[model samples]
Target: MSSLFDPAQIGDIAVANRIVMAPLTRNRAIAGNVAGPLTVEYYRQRASAGLIIAEASQISPLAQGYLDTPGIHTPEQVAGWRQVTDAVHAEGGKIVLQLWHVGRISHSSLLPDGAAPVSSSSRRSEAKTFTRDGFLPVSAPRALRDDELPGLIDDYRRAARNAIAAGFDGVEVHAANTYLLEQFLRDSVNDRSGPYGGSIANRARLLLEVMQAIVAEIGGGRTGIRLSPLTTFGGTTPLDSDPQALYGYVVEQLAPLGLAFLHVIEGETGGTRNPPAAKPFDYEALHRSFPGAWMVNNGYSRALAMETVAEGKADLVAFGRPFISTPDLVYRLSHDAPLNELRADKLYGGGAEGYTDYPTLAA
Candidate 1:
């Protein structure tokens, strides 16, 4: 029987416990996408998690979708992240960087030279993205040219290298939640007729290539990938035919790569969908499709997480909002302490007010 506070080994890193701090976007980075001092303090405070997956970080300038999100593509960005990783490690924590590309879910306010966002097809997502001003409507992105894919692949490789340079223990590719990789994987948005589209294998090529590039830069044991099989957010609309086959095939292909782990988001995060009704495709079946460690997240109570792990349905469970309000979530869970409520208004683009203000048990 595995407890949330019990130690576990994930890939090349030895975790302090089974509790993982899921990657969360705080929107605290400064200009030029450089992580600020506040960012360092925030992660340092939550370093007690067995493994800390840093916020969704852009792999390239074009990958920017929301204002103030950090990036790992620049030297300054790398140095900024080094400060964060150093602080986390000093607290005896292991952290992984999550590389992100938002694709059509981006707004012009966060784009390079005011260029439209890029995606597999020229389609506009009905999703709204946060900007410096406020939440704005996302624009239709330009279709990525065939000649530009190799460069995009290079972007992921460089981002992985940057993560290593930034003192991170590993990296997690963000292929979920209607981001760039999800945009490519979903058939409703990806209507390209080229080698990178049309068939399921072709649609999955870009994500596979990106994973390979990251693994090439960093060993497979140091690389992880996050995916959302039943995700429909950010203009991600999977064909109703059989998502099981598409995602099962993806896991099968990824199984041979021996990735560090597979992080899956079961369903909607900010919606009113019932958990029982929105239960994602059989996660255990999907876990079997992949030969690596499997982690499941989204609206999981402490008891539910414990039950899931006890049943061997998930090797590990990730907590998102609970971690935000409880910096010492593992300790609190261990002792059955009450968790502080997270203020919805202070989630994104806020300063250190709600970011690092959460009190620890010892404090």
Candidate 2:
């Protein structure tokens, strides 16, 4: 019987186990959005994960949404990440970088020269974003002109190439949460009328185009994507009355690409997988829609992960907060050892206090 500890393969990457470290934004990058030595130590300590999807990294200067979040655009950032990948690979661990564009989810303070954030429409998210100064209200984003989308796609393409140059095993496109891609996918925010809006096909065009470009730059087997269908994080509510139809179509469209894997956050992003009070969407239906390797995230326990894999519900499971405090998460899960509680106070923007100082079983 297949177990979480059993070996699994996603595309060309071979993992020792099915415990994936979900892309978590630690907000610890140094000035210029560069991953420094501390970032290397943080990931290296957690290299026991079958696969580590590095935090949401901006694809361009305009993509940044938070202070100290890393970027893949500049040469310095690429070199900085090269150290991270090298450390992970040295420990026989696989790592992938997540390409991100915050869109309207960003504050003006985080934007280039205090420029307004950009999105599918001119909507200003009511959600607050973390800036160097502190948490601030998100600014209204300028509607991206139809002509400018190609430039945005190019940014993703360039970032994919940069990930390869940085020695990353692959790249996961961040389409989840309320980022640029989600802003375009949901009708609640997308109010444009053109090839990039209106119909479901139009709304999904940018994501597909970006994926196609990335696949063109790197092979499809080396690329992946993350999607959150029912998440309300960052104030992203479902605008479509039938989210099943919306995400079903999206997953169906993604199936043909033959990418590495599709990572889905089955519940509220960064929240419980099965919230008792909420009427959850039939995530199983969407999981069945994608023919590729499916990775389910959100509030997964060791027993639940093993059960999901054994029952053939998902091929892999991703853990987020647990990884923050347990660097050797796979070992702890495999041995049924107790886990260290994450310091909620130090979840973001800290040096070594709660970052790499989290003791493993060895300590």
Candidate 3:
């Protein structure tokens, strides 16, 4: 049986266990979107996790959606990430940076000179994003000109380089969560008539291009991508045609890349709005589509996670809220200890109150 504590390999990186720390965004970075000492301590405390996927970090100034979120496109940001990577490594832990580009989900208040967010098409997302003031409505983003697609791809490539320079073990492309990449992938948001719109293949072009650029820069084994097939956010409505065909085609295209791994966010992030109870999608069909390590997240308990791995349904399991309140989650799971509950009030935009205050089990 594959145990949760057993060592596993996700591409080139050798993870000590299967208890991955799923990326959780805590708006606690410095004013310039730089990782600070507090961020360092937060990751170091949870080094026991099999692998840690750092919070979503913007790849450019225009990618900023939430206030105080970290970035990787600047020298100061790289230096700040170095502090975090060094701290985690010192504790014998492995960490990966999640490169993000929030396209239409961004607000003008978060952009430089208060410019509108950019996307594949000029459409306004009906979603609200976090800002310095509070959660505010998103605005229509400027469409990326046909000549500018290459530049956006270059931005992702440069961000991958910066992540490596910051001493990260690898980089996971934030193609999920209705962000920039997802914006382009979804048909509802991408109504352009160019090569990047209409058919599923065209919609998937940007993600594949970005992946190719990152692979060219750091090889396929050092790159990973996250996807949320069933999520509906940021004006991302499900295609009435056929979702299985759309997502299956995506997985088939990505399978041959031989990338690090594919992380899937099963459903909603948290228990915010109750997701409609529908029959679960055919994961076995989708899992076979990607010929690489697979990590599953969302409302997963230890028992369920272990079962999924033992049954060969998933290679690894990620925990989001559990890690938020339990810094020593892996140890607790290994010993069958009770976990601490997370306080929702301090989840986002807070200092270190409930962030790094989770206590570890004494020896």
Candidate 4:
């Protein structure tokens, strides 16, 4: 049986253990959407994880949605991340950046010149986003022209290259939640006609294109992607009508690319592992289709994580909220120690008080 604490090779990066720190967005970026010194310290403190998937960062300025979320598009942002990557590496940890684009889940105030957010279609989401004015309704988005897709694909390609330039071991494209790529994926949201939308093959085009572009830029070994087949954005969005068919095709297409891993959020994100209203979607089917590490997220307990790995259900288990409060989560899990409760407040746009001040076992 594989142990959760055992070393495993994920793509091109070799991790110390199978306990991964899933990406958690903390709106603490400084000016120019650059991760600051505190950001460096925050990651440095949690470097013991087998793998640290750094918080979601926008691929371009226009891709940004929430206030103060970091971006990997600019030179300054790359420099900012260099410090973070260097810090984690010094601790002998492997870290990867999660490339993001929020789509319609953004407000005008967060965009350039108060521009509308863009999406797979002109439909606006009922979702809200964190802005300078606080939580506000997302702005209506303009449908992206087919001609504009190449530039967007190039943006993702560039972001992957920039992540490599910034000293990251690899990059995880954030196609999960109700983000841009997922927006294009879920037929519930994507309402367009062209090469980018319509049938499952068309809907899967943009994500595949983005993946292929990134793989072409940095090679598939250094590439990973996150997917939330049933994450409903807190039930705000409808579940994809045919998740199994859609994601099955997605993984099947990704099989030949040699991706490092596939991070999947089981059930609703940050909620019940088995959502009552959700149709039964076969997660294992997707695993069999891909020839990469299978990283499962969403409500994973230490026991469950161990059992999954031991049974060969999953290769790596990711913990999100637990890692926020317990920087020494791997140690605690291996020792069966209790975890510190998360500070409900100060999750976003905060300083060290709730960000880096969480006490570890050593402290």
Candidate 5:
């Protein structure tokens, strides 16, 4: 029987334990959207995690949606992340960057030359994004033409290469949470008609292409992808007309890629783990198709995580908020200790107060 605290192999990455730190957006990037010393210290503090999926970072300047979030497209940004990976490596921890593109979830103010955010459809999201002006409605996006898709694919490929350049062990493609890929994944949002839209395969085309490109650039053993089949991000986005068939096809398609792992959000992104009344998705079926490690996330308790691992239900368990408030979460869990309270107010864009100020058992 597998224990949650035992070491495991996640593809090319060897983890000390199955406790993972899910990618969290702190919006604390320095000038030019670069990870600074503070960002380095923040990740270094939580290096005890088996695998640290670093925060969602824009693959390009136009990929940004929130203020102060880091980017990986520029030389300065790459150098900035090198510091983070170095720190984690020194502490015997493994880290990977989450490559992101907000698509229609972004505001024009966050884009280059105020370009309208691009997406599978031009229809705008009712959701709001955190900008310098504060949370506001997302701007209408221009439908990405079929011709333009090659460039977008290249952007993902470049980001994967940049991750390697920055000394990361691997990269996790951010295709979840009603973001760019999810915008296309759901029939509720992508209303375009063309080779890039309409059918489920067409809808999943961009995401699959992005994954293939990244895998080719860095190999599948060094790549993972995150997916949220039923997450509406608190109804800011709607569910896919057929969440099961849609994600089912997605998981089946990704099986041959030999990915390192597939990180799944069980229910609502940060909301209920209990499947909603109307939305019914068989997550276990998806788990059965994948050959690599199966990492489960969203509101997991220590007992639940342990049982999930112990029962062979999930190979790894990812914790989001718990890791934020408890840097020594592994130790706390080992001893069944209490966790620190999260400073909700200072979650996004702040100094070390709520970001890295959380005390550990050693403190």
Candidate 6:
């Protein structure tokens, strides 16, 4: 039977355990989308994790959708992240960067020169986003032309290369949480009539293309992707008759890619595992769809994580909010220590109060 402390290997990276510290957005980057000392200390404090998936960082300037989210496309950004990677490596921990591009989940205040957010179709999402002032309404996005997709693909490829240059162990494509990739994935939101839309294969085209381009730069062994099958996080409804068939086909297409692991958020993003009256889809069926190591996430406690892994339901378990208040979460769980309470007020766009001042067991 496998435990959370058991050793495992996801692609080329060898992890010390199966407890993964999931990517979390802290909105603490410095000017020019560069990570700084606060970011370094935050990750370094939690280096006990089996693997750390760093927060979502933009792949290009046009990819910015939040005030202080970090990026991997600039020389200064790379240098800033190099410090973070060095700190994590010094503590003998493995880390991966989650590359992100928020599509319609942005306000003009978050864009360059007040450019409108872009997505697969010219529809407005009923989602709100964080800005310098506060949470603001997301604008209706303009649909991307067929020719414009190639540039976005190149951005992902370059970001993967930059991750390597910045000394990260690997990179994970942020294809979940109703971001740019998921905006194109859900049929209800994407009404484009090109090769990039209309069917499961067509809607999944950009995601697969981006994966192929990144794999070309960094081998498939060092690359991975995150997927949310039934999460209507940003008010995205799947109008497709069968979401099971759609995601199953997507997973089948990804099987042969030989990427690292597929991170799946089982239920609603950042919410309960069993959402009441939600659309029903077989989790076991989705787990069996991908032939690679499957990572399970969303609303998991230490007991549940251990039980799921022991039952062979998943190869890894990722924790989100708990890690924010407990720096040594792995140790706390394994040794049955008490966890610190989370201060939700200081979660985003702050200095180091709730960011890095959390006490560990050592304190």
Per-prediction RMSD in angstroms? Answer: 1.7, 1.3, 1.9, 0.7, 0.8, 1.2
lDDT of 3: 0.87
lDDT of 2 by residue, 261-352 (tens): 99998877877666554465888887777777789998988899999999989999999999998999999999999999889999889899
- lDDT of each model, Cα atoms only? 0.87, 0.90, 0.87, 0.93, 0.93, 0.89
Q: Kindly report which residue stretches of model 5 are placed more than 4 angstroms away from their true locations once superposed.
A: 275-277
**Candidate 3 residue 8 C-alpha distance from true site, Å:** 0.5
- Candidate 2's displacement at residue 244, Å, is 0.7
How badly does each model clash, as a count of residue pairs? 0, 0, 0, 0, 0, 0
Select the stronger candidate by TM-score from 3 and 6: 6
Misplaced by over 4 Å in model 2 are 234-239, 274-280
Which stretches of candidate 1 lie above 4 Å from their native place?
A: 234-240, 271-280
- Ranked by lDDT, top first: 4, 5, 2, 6, 1, 3
Best by lDDT: 4
**TM, every model:** 0.96, 0.97, 0.96, 0.99, 0.99, 0.97
lDDT computed for candidate 1: 0.87
Candidate with better lDDT, 2 vs 6: 2
Sequence-dependent TM-score of model 3:
0.96
lDDT of 5 by residue, 149-196 (tens): 899999999999999999999999999999999988999999988877
Instruction: Write the number of the candidate with greater TM-score, choosing between 1 and 2.
Output: 2
lDDT of predicted model 4:
0.93
- In candidate 5 the C-alpha lDDT for residue 47 amounts to 95
**Clashing pairs in model 2, backbone N/Cα/C closer than 3 A:** none
